[model samples]
Target chain A: MTEEPKPRRLTPKGRATRDRIIEAATELIARNGVAGTGIEDVRAAAGVSGSQLYHYFDSKQALIRAVITRQADSVLHPDQPRVTALDSFDALRAWADAAIERQRENGCRGDCTLGSLAGELSVSDEESRTDLATGFLRWKDLILDGLRAMRDRGGLRADADLDELALSLLTALQGGVLLSQTMLHVRPLEAAMNASLAYVHSFATTAGR
Target chain B: MTEEPKPRRLTPKGRATRDRIIEAATELIARNGVAGTGIEDVRAAAGVSGSQLYHYFDSKQALIRAVITRQADSVLHPDQPRVTALDSFDALRAWADAAIERQRENGCRGDCTLGSLAGELSVSDEESRTDLATGFLRWKDLILDGLRAMRDRGGLRADADLDELALSLLTALQGGVLLSQTMLHVRPLEAAMNASLAYVHSFATTAGR
Candidate 1:
């Protein structure tokens, strides 16, 4: 399906309508999955008129992409994290702790929105799969930036593979969260993050610490 | 939906029909998510008549559970591994290598079948979610058994927590495969498994090697 270009600018009212549609779609998809959630369901949940729903999202793919973007933003730029870069072990621990804490608070019912989308869309949808991959890369880059900062500061060993380290941590988080969601427990996520954090710590220069 | 109890005993012909249905459903779900694949698709793919499909699987959820079990068996008990227990570091590396090699061979098109099902059903279907969780636990147990053997053989430190190690490895795997499938690359899986293996290695006794 061809995805119509979303308008770059919108009136305040238009923006509100569009946000409502995305919010509803996100919730529905979270519960019922993308295939289970229909366009009519989104329109009904958003309470937007038929033409209004089409005005913002030309196709379901476009709406799903919007959801993916929103999920990436929420995950990558959470409000609690004042700093974007994880420059130190303490910062990294805090990042891991925050994730585990969130899962506990939520009772581990919902999986990561981005990860859930990836699991559902990656194999079946090429365009959506690329978007999911981009989201993962951006997430990996955020961690990479921190690893780079740590290396520059002499906190990490010079020989440590920063790219591998970043990818490993992201992988651990994604895997950990998925298990936690499925099992309705936080142990898997905690263990995965703890092990990954230990791996990063292994490369830490004691003098820098 | 009520699930009909699977008959305890089936004639060879009856078993073949059931297996055929499951095989078809597995392929369909692999290409399209659980929500996307329907009973009709499975029946058509299996070349079974309408009542024949129902005779085996009372509901879609029942069929999905069978798929989950089959995937778990295929993943956890592949034909290539002679020894199921990963007692040594080399064995662990080989296990990880086999998974990476499979992804490479497949060109990273299919996500792990059990994982894909988990991603789709873990949130929406309680019964299927439980089955998935059981499958993950069984997989984790295989790793745990290896870790326990390693500790007993004095290859791993006695102080090491085997549960955490096993969970971490499994988490890394699920996460790594998910990323590899989504990104259509093997690097993420490599990084994740490498880091996990290294973590396991950290506990190896000096004398064990």
Candidate 2:
């Protein structure tokens, strides 16, 4: 789902138009799903003529790929700086809180970006699936990095399988966010995160334990 | 999301036609999302005239409601006789195994029906969200029932919170199934289920544990 790199240079006006199209398409697709939002709707919403829209994005798929990248960036915002600094248990709890807070701020709607994309496109679209998977891996790698930090700092047990634990923690977060979005309640997300955190804490160093 | 109960009376041919429409719609929607699969597509797939399609379902949403019901039924199949009988840790493990086995048999492709529906329709369509939430609740209640059974049998600690545990387990399964389907691997699902199972076992009585 990767698009060709943008042109080497653009006028300020040209850059603004491209950003406008992506922002409009993102909101439209988020409100109406990928299938429900058509190129015409995007062109109208972005206020760009057909020729201009085609100049930036060759097809609807290319536009969607840009949206996915933008959404992924938004989803990973909470983990910035701290993702590389998550050496303590409390840091993990704070990370979870940030995720839950973001969902609550959005009224527990829209769901996760990568998750929504994966659910809609993963089964039918191979290229989109790969793109969504890449987004997930980026998130996963950040968490893995945190766990590795904990291990190096003697916060986690030496034998703990960081890869498996990291994936499990991510699974919990995804599941929790989904339930929270569906039920319009925060408890499910809290419970899922707590459960995963508890699992991570189980591998604490003897002194920490 | 629930239809006014189907007409109390129908001829054999009438019942057959309704069933055919539902089957075709379910397959089509499962392959292409609710928005992607048009009524005309269902009509063609089922070999029904436009009038026949309209006779059974007044609108696409109505047909989707029926498909949601059908998918809910499939998802709840494992909870039938076995849920009432799940009074031990081993029984819970068996339940997890069954879920994983089904996904494995499907090559981890389809993912969770209710989850997919919720992801696509929950935000944009309130009726469908309510329907999918109801389906999730039914599954949660069965797990709650089994946890209650274990509690009453002294298989669980007196202080165990069955409701939270049950929701957490369901959350884990939903997340696991989603990751497994996207990665085309079963480890994420297995890990999530294992973590939940371990939580359940943590409450087990001495001999039962």
List ranges where model 1 is wrong by over 4 Å.
Answer: A1-4, A76-78, B1-4, B75-78
Instruction: Tell me the TM-score of candidate 2's A chain.
Output: 0.87
Q: In model 1 chain B, which range of ten residues has the least summed lDDT? A: B1-10
Once fitted onto the true fold, the runs of candidate 2 whose alpha carbons sit more than 4 angstroms away are: A4-17, A44-49, A75-84, B2-7, B11-13, B78-86, B205-208
Q: Using TM-score as the measure, which candidate wins? A: 1
Residue pairs clashing, model 2: none
**lDDT of each residue in A134-208, candidate 1, tens digit only:** 888888898999999999989999999999999999888888888898899999999989888988989999865
Best by lDDT: 1
Worst 10 residues of 2 chain A by lDDT: A75-84
Report clash pairs, candidate 1: none
Q: TM-score of every model?
A: 0.94, 0.89
Residues B123-193 of candidate 1 have per-residue lDDT tens digits of: 77788888889889988998899899889989999999899999999988888888898888999999989
lDDT tens per residue, model 2, A34-88: 8778999999999999999999999998888877777766645654655545657
For candidate 1, the docking band is: medium
Per-prediction DockQ scores? Answer: 0.75, 0.59
Full-model lDDT, candidate 2: 0.78
